[model samples]
Structures are given as C-alpha cells and as structure tokens.
Target chain A: DARVTQTPRHKVTEMGQEVTMRCQPILGHNTVFWYRQTMMQGLELLAYFRNRAPLDDSGMPKDRFSAEMPDATLATLKIQPSEPRDSAVYFCASGLTADGKGAADTQYFGPGTRLTVL
Target chain B: DQQVKQNSPSLSVQEGRISILNCDYTNSMFDYFLWYKKYPAEGPTFLISISSIKDKNEDGRFTVFLNKSAKHLSLHIVPSQPGDSAVYFCASGYKAAGNKLTFGGGTRVLVKP
Candidate 1:
C-alpha cells in the first residue's frame, strides 16, 4: 500500500511570499514528476526527475520556480515571490522505469497540495 | 499549443449505461496514451493505457481504443456506476520524450444513480 505523499495539503500565502511544497515518492520508485493544475490550463507538467537527477524543467518558470530531489525519497518544489497566477493544485507522481520501460507506462499520484496566493 | 485535448468538458450518464470519453493528440510522434481519473480534491490516478502498436486494451470494465491514423483515442466504461463519476484526463507521450506526460483538459463525468 505504498503511495506518493505530499505535505501541506493546503497552503494559503500572500502574494510575493515564498512557498515550498514537498513530496515523498513511493519507495523504490525511480522517477518523479511535478505538475500544476489550474482551471484555465488544466494540468501542465512543470518538471521531472529520474534517478535523482533532473531530466527536464523547461515547463517551469525559471525566475520564480525551482524543483529538486535532495535524495531518492524526498523531492521539493519551491516558488519564490509567489503570485496569484501561481496559485494552483500541485501534484507529485512517481513511477518505475528501470528496465528500458516507456516513461509514460504508469504513474501513481499523491494527494495534491492546494496552493492559494492571495 | 496543446498537444493533447479532451474536447468535452463534462458528460452525464445513467447508471448501468456506458460512458465514453474521447481524447485527441496532435503529436504524431506520441506512441503511448493513458487515461486517468481524478476525484475532487484528489490527485489523478492511472486507469488505463494503450500503446500505439496496439489498437485496444481492456481491463475489467475499462477499455481504451486507439486510432493512430486519426490521432485519437477513447475510454469506454461499461455498466457505469456512481463511483465512476470523476474527472477523466487523457495523456500522451513518446518513449523518446522521457517520462514527461502531456495531459489534456479533463472531461468530468457524472453518473446518475
């Protein structure tokens, strides 16, 4: 019954404040992903990591957003100078692709962190 | 531009009926497609997936059909139940693209009991 776990299930912050969201991927899962879900844009991939290494962060806004996996079990997404537009439910997902498996084959998601910038 | 799209914003179906959700992708390079179900306040969960090499895949009451030529795919749920009500998202990606998944705007399904 292992599942991805995200902390601070709900966050309310003022504009220009810094926010950090954390996730603990399922044990032994080798890949991690961060996504933002908004009413206007639906769900967007913000960043991803494989084997504790960042593979792509192109979807993330470099100026204000940063994602890192300090270790296999812990991953974090930080937003500096958070704005109202940055308010959205952030999700963390993890999967195993150790044996030449397709990256999108399967993923398990954690209960998302709902961020609100007022 | 959105690479994956789910045109229908919402769908209503009677219990015991069949619910069909459609998805389309613009990327010809996409070789894998997946369907996920999300409840309010919860993260999306993987439901079913199909490979471009195969036209269809079925698990229990859930079935996914893929038409490569049309660049379209669909999820069919037979004997739909109240628990099946949720927002359904379709995602697509290619093997070469790594683990990043491009998700479509979800289609919310309401099953009336």
Candidate 2:
C-alpha cells in the first residue's frame, strides 16, 4: 500500500521561531498539495506543485510562509517567524496527473503534522 | 465566504440504520463533488463522489446523490457501524480550474450499537 509520508508528526515551537514540515509523496505521484486545518478555518489550501513546479501559492502568506518541492520525492512547507495563528495541522496530499486537466485529480493525503506555536 | 456548507455539526445513528449527511454549495460553477471521511489524528480518506452530469452514484454500502439545480449533495451510509463513526467533509471543484477542492465544515457522525 502506497501512502504519503510526513515527518515530525507533531511539533511545538515558540512564536517567532522557524518551523519546517516535510512530506514525501507517493513514488509515482506527480502533484503535491499543502493544506492547513484549524478549528476556525476548517481546511485551506496553502499551495501546490505539479511536476516539482509550483502551480499556485496564492493562499499562502507571502511574508511568513513558503512551500517548495525541491525534488520529486521531497516537498516542504516552511514558516519563518511563525505566529500563534499559524498553529494548525498541515497536510500534504499527492495525486497522479498526466495531463493538466482537473478531471484526473484524485488526491491521497498524508497523516498530517500537528503544529503548536506558543 | 463559505462556498460549501454542512449545516449540521454532528449526527447520530443507530447500528444497522441509515446515516444521511447533507451538503449545500453556493457556487454554481462547481462541477465535481466529493465526500471524505476523517478519523481523529488521521487524514481524510476519500469516500464517494458525484459529477454534475449524474444524479446518483453508488458503491457497495455507500451512495452519493447530487442535485445540480438545488446545488445540493448528500452521502448515505446504510447499516452504519461503529467503524463508520468519523467526520465527513464535503468538497467541490470547478471543472476549468486546477481542481483545488473547496471543502465545507465537516459533520461528525456517531454510530451507536
């Protein structure tokens, strides 16, 4: 059974500290997405990449948050000077997309990293 | 604005009974809808999905009904079991977009034996 693997299942950091969450998508999947889930906001997409190239990062906070797929296997979401408001569960999802079409998008999600910023 | 809405925060059902979870959307552009089930500390898993072109889709004990005109959709689980107790989320995607799913606030389903 293939699954998306996420590192550091739980994290606790002081405010203004740097936090980095990593994900290893399924081997053959080509698309990866980063999402944040909180009690207030539910689930919100922060960014996504296709073929290691970022397709959109509009939902991400430009000043403090960054998401990147350095290679096919590794994807990371980093926050500098993280705030308490950034405390949420971050999930990474992978999907197989041969074409650019939306019809082929079927995402398989990771277990998620729970972050608590004090 | 909440594009997708699940009005009920939770639902309770008896074992061997039917559980119906409803979702409504305000966006007329949404063409594809999906249902996901999530347990505590676990990621949401895909359950059932329906396209705007179809009214109903069924798989095993699960079924999804879509009402395009009303912009509503529902998930039905027959013979609800203890294992089926989880949070269910409704998501919708636009056909021309990148399939970035906009999700609704989930409804927690409790099954009692």
Candidate 3:
C-alpha cells in the first residue's frame, strides 16, 4: 500500500532553536501539502506544492516558517527561532496534481511529526 | 472566520446503532465536501466525500449526504463498532481552486459495546 511517510515522529526543542520536519509522499503523487493541528486552531494549512513548485504559503507565518519540496518525493517544513507557540502536530499530505477528477480526488496523509517547542 | 462548522464537540453511540455527524458551511464557493477520521498520534485520513451535484454517496457502512441549498452535509455510520471511535473532521473545498481543504473543528465519537 502506498502511504505518505514523515520522519521524526516526535521532537522536543528549546525556544529559539531551529526545527525541520521531513516528509516522503506516496509514489506517483505530484501535489504535497503541509498542515498544522492544535487544540485551539484545529487544522490549518501552512503551505503546499504542485509538481515540486510552491503553490501557496499564505497561511504560514512568513517570518518563522518555510516549506519546500526538494523533489517529487521529499518535502520539508522548517521553522527558525521556533517559539513555544509553534508547538503542534505537523502533517504532510499527497494528492494527484490533476483536477479532472473533480471533488472525488482526495489526499493521503502521513503519520505526522509531533513537535514541542519549549 | 471559520467557513466550515461542526457544532457538536463529541457524540456517543452504542454498538449496532447509527451515528450521525453533521457539518455546515457558510461559503457557497465550496462545491465539494469531505470527511476525515483521525486517531491519536496520527494524521487525519480521508473517510468519504460528496460533491454539490450529488445528494448522497455511500461506501459500506459509511454514507455521506449533502444538501447544497442548506449548505449542510452529514455522515452516517450504521452499526457503529468499537473500532469506529475516533475524531471526525469535515472539510470543504472550491472545485475551481486546487484541492486546498478548509477543515472544521472535529467531533470526537465514542462507541460503546
């Protein structure tokens, strides 16, 4: 079964430290998305890429967060000078790049990286 | 502002009973809706989806009903089982745009045997 995979299932870092989370999307999927989940905000999309190109990063904090897809399979999200407020589960999802399927097309998600910034 | 809303924070159902979860949206631009289920320490997984053109779609025990006029959608799980317990999230998306899902606060469901 093809599954989206994320590395470092858990992380604990000091405030002001840099944190990087990595993801390996399912093979053949061309679209990638990064999301943050917290008790207060629920699920928020930070950024996404299509065909290894950044499509939108409007929801992300520009000063502290960055998302990139180095290649089709590897996608990364990084936070510099991470603050305690950045603590949340970061999820990566993959989907088809084409939209001809309409609403039927769906995204497959990874297990997620749980980051705790102190 | 939250475009999608799941008012109930949690729902409880007994085995062999039907559990219905509802979601409402404010944006008419949202032409598609999806349901996702999540367990602790894991990301949300796609459960089911329905388009604005269709009123209902079903897969096994799970069924989704959409009412475009009311801007509402619901998920029905018949014969709820212990394994069915989890947090369910409702998401909406605009068909013209790429699949960037706008999700609602999830509802935690508990199934008792």
Candidate 4:
C-alpha cells in the first residue's frame, strides 16, 4: 500500500535546540501538509505545500519554524531554538490535487513524529 | 476559536451494539465533513465523510449523518467490534477555501467484547 512515511517517530530534545522532522509523501501525491497536535490545542496546520511550492505557512511560528519540500519525494519541517511549547505530535499528510484545482483534497496522514522538548 | 467540537471525550459500547459519535461545528462555510479513526501512536485514518449537499452517506458498517441546519454531524458504527476501539476525530472543510480541514479534539471509543 502506498503510505506517507515519516522519520524519527519519536524524538527528545532540549529547549533551544534545533529539531528537524522529515516526510516522504506517497508517490505521485502533489500536495503536502504539516500539522501539530497537542492536548490543549488539538490539531493545528503548521504549513502546506502544493506542487512543491509553499501555499501557506500562516499557522507556523514565523521566527522559529520553517517548512520545505526539498524534492518531490521529501518534505521537511524544522524548528530552531525550539521551546517547550513546541512539544507535540507533528503529522505530515499528502494528497492529490484533484482536477488541477484545490477542491476535493483528501489527505492521508503519516504515522507522525512525537517531539518532546525538555 | 474552535470551529469544530466533539463534546464527548469518551464513550463505551458493547460489541454488536451501535456506537454513535457526534460532532458540531461553528463554521457556516464548511461544506464537507469527514470522520477519522486513530489508534495509539498511529495517524488518524479516514473513516467516512458527508457533503453538505447530502444529509447521509454510508460505507459498509459505518454511516455519516449531517444536519446542516444544526451544523452538526454524526458517525454511526453498527455492530461495533473490538477493533472499533479508537479515538475518533471529526473534520470540516470548505472546498472553496483551499480544502483546509479543521479538526475536533476527538473522542475515544471503547468497545467491550
């Protein structure tokens, strides 16, 4: 089965450290998304890419968080000078852009990377 | 503001019984809704979905009911099995709004076999 793959299923890092999470979207999928899930905030969209170009990153912390799709198969989410508040399960999802439009997007999520910031 | 809400944090149901999970949304622009099931340490898996144009949609043992007027939708799993025990999340989306899904906090369902 074609599935989104994520790296470092679990990670523990100290505050102020740099954390990087990688994802391999399902082959042929054209859109990728990054999300953060916490007990208090639920699920929040951190960033998204369409055709390997960022469509939105408004939900991310502009100063410390960045997301990129270095190639068709790889997408990455990075946090610099990470803080305790950044500790959460980060999920990566990919979907096909139906009919060349943004409609009918059905996302399939990866196993998610659990980040623990001490 | 939380656009989607799953008020019940958890529920328990006997095997072979019907398990109903409810969700409500405050966003009037949402045109599509979906249900997802998640196991511990796993990503949410797609369960079922309903569009605003239709009040009901079904797939096998799962059914999704939508009440657009009330901004509420529900997932019904008939003849619940032990494998149905998982966290359920409700997500809402607007096709015109880039299809970005807004998800609820999720409800944990336990099926006693």
Against the true structure, whose DockQ is highest? Answer: 1
| Model 3 Cα lDDT, one tens digit per residue, A1-118 | 8999999999999999999999999999878899999998899999978788888899999999999887888999999989999999999999884653333258889999999998
Candidate 1 C-alpha lDDT tens digits along B29-108: 99989999999999999999998999999999999999999999999999899999999999998888777789999999
Show the lowest summed lDDT stretch of 10 residues, model 4 chain A. Answer: A97-106
Pairs clashing in candidate 2?
none
Worst 10 residues of 3 chain B by lDDT: B92-101
Please give, for every candidate in the order listed, the TM-score of chain B alone compared with the true chain B: 0.99, 0.98, 0.98, 0.98
Better of 2 and 3 by DockQ: 2
DockQ category of candidate 2: medium
Q: Judge candidate 4 against the unseen true structure and give its global Cα lDDT, from 0 to 1.
A: 0.92
- Of 1 and 2, the candidate ahead on TM-score is 1
**Model 2 quality (TM-score):** 0.96
True contacts kept of each: 0.72, 0.43, 0.48, 0.49
Error of 2 at A13 (Å): 0.7
> What lDDT would each prediction earn against the true structure?
0.94, 0.91, 0.91, 0.92
Candidate 4 DockQ vs. native: 0.67
* CAPRI level of candidate 3: medium
* Candidate 3 Cα misplacement greater than 4 A, ranges: A99-104
Per-residue lDDT tens digits of candidate 2, residues B6-104? 999999999999999999999998888999999999999888888888999999889999999899999999979999999999999875656578889
Q: Which ten residues in a row have the lowest lDDT in candidate 1 chain B?
A: B92-101
lDDT of 4 by residue, A60-111 (tens): 9999999999999999999999999999999999988776567655789999
